[model samples]
Target chain A: QQPVQSPQAVILREGEDAVINCSSSKALYSVHWYRQKHGEAPVFLMILLKGGEQKGHEKISASFNEKKQQSSLYLTASQLSYSGTYFCGTVTTSGTYKYIFGTGTRLKVLA
Target chain B: NAGVTQTPKFRILKIGQSMTLQCTQDMNHNYMYWYRQDPGMGLKLIYYSVGAGITDKGEVPNGYNVSRSTTEDFPLRLELAAPSQTSVYFCASSYRIMPFINSGGGSDIQYFGAGTRLSVL
Candidate 1:
């Protein structure tokens, strides 16, 4: 099943912070975060494996809660370049490694 | 490096016409996938292949068919196009499992193509 993302859209000023959440109905083995600017393919951000782990890169971070079957992405001190839609792709515990993408969160960062 | 490339960036078709969306990856990856994205929705998997000569259906494969005859190519076929099939299609490739010892995990990180936008009237 597809994961659900909260806060369909959000607008922020430069240097602000934002949080995007992804919830799955089934347990997940791993979660991947990506950002897509308008008219471009999604760029991979980070991936969090199962075991309630957390991973990050620079100002972007993500956490996966195995027990809750959910993951949250945190963008710190956002920049104008951060304006884009974020999606979380999940792989379930079934071990099939079939990816299911969340609905997505549209974020706009103002100058 | 042309990591992944999709043909016919934009196309238009009639309701009963048929067409193929071509995809090729130069990375020699073992896995490839096809996904469709509606205007405001996330990508929905239509089909995937573990390797050459192998293919499988995904969540929204009802109106799509796929074939993976070579390692570098995987194409999605719309046998009978419909207006509902109008959307942007993306082709992606990934390693079956990360190979490096220092790699984060066994998880597969996908690399996507520019995408093909199709509209069926």
Candidate 2:
């Protein structure tokens, strides 16, 4: 099943912060985040495993909550390059070896 | 490496027409997937293969078919195309990551092709 993403769309200033959340009904083994610019393929951001670790790179960070079966992506001091659609891919505990993507959240960062 | 390559970047097919979208990967990955993306929507998996000669349906596999004849190639076939099938198609390949060796504890990152834009008239 596809995961659900909150705040279908968001607009932010270049120096602002934004959060995108993905939730699944089933138990997830891992969550993968990607960002796709207009007319481009999705690019891998980061992957969070079941250990509930919070991973970060630059001003981008993500957290996985095993208990809630959800994940949240944090983009701080958003840059113009951050304008794009964000998606979260999930792998369930069923061992199906299939990755399901979320509905997606569109974020537009303005100067 | 031309990680993942897809052919016929743009195509238009009449209703009832049939076509095949070709995908090839040089990364020697064991897993390949076909996904479709509609306007303003995330990708929907249509089919996936674990290895050559093995294929399985994904979330939305109603009007499509796929075959993995060789490790390097996986093709998606559309039969009797309909207007609803008009969308952008993407092919991705990835290798399995060992949990013990990787802290991420999941499959390797998927490399996507440029994507094929199909329009069914």
Candidate 3:
């Protein structure tokens, strides 16, 4: 099933912080975060595996809660380059090689 | 490495016309996927392959088909395309994680293609 993302859209000023949440109905084995700029391919940000681990990339970070079947992407001190649509791809506990992406969260960071 | 490459960056097809979106990965990844992204929406998986000759349907596979004849190539076929099939198609590949050895640190990072924009009228 496709995951659901909260705060369909968010606007932040430079240096501001924002959080994007992704929740799945099924148990998840891993959660992958990606950001897509306008007319560009989705770029891999980070992947959070089960065991409630947290991962970070630059000022961005993510946490996965296997028990809750949810993950959250954190963007601190946002930059203009941070403006993009954030998507979360989830792999369920079925151990399949498929990834179901979330609806997406559009973040626009202004100067 | 070119990473994931897709052909025919833009295409326009009439209703009922069929076309194939080509995807190739130089990373030698074992896992490949096909997804479509409609405007203002996230990607929806159409098909995936764990390895050469091993393909499977995904969440939205009704209007499309896929084949993995080689480890480096996975193509998506749209038979009798419809207006609903018009969207940006993306091909992605990733390294499959072993059962327990690399489960904790396996690189599940999926490298994406440039995307093919298809318009069906």
Clashing pairs in 2: none
lDDT of 2 by residue, B1-121 (tens): 7889999999999999999999999989888999999988889889999889999988899999999999999999999999999999999998875442343554756789999999999
Candidate 2: residue A52 lDDT (0-100): 81
Error of 3 at A4 (Å): 1.6
Q: Candidates sorted by TM-score, descending order?
A: 2, 3, 1
Residue B73 of model 1: what lDDT?
99
Relative to the unseen true structure, what is the C-alpha lDDT of residue A33 in candidate 2, on a scale of 0 to 100?
93
Best by TM-score: 2
The DockQ ranking, best first, is: 3, 1, 2
Chain A TM per candidate, in order of listing: 0.95, 0.96, 0.95
Model 1 scores a C-alpha lDDT of 0.90
Query: Which of candidates 2 and 3 is the stronger one according to DockQ?
Result: 3
By DockQ thresholds, what CAPRI class is model 2?
Answer: medium
lDDT, candidate 3, A45-72, per-residue tens = 8888765889889999999988889899
TM-score per candidate, chains pooled? 0.91, 0.93, 0.92
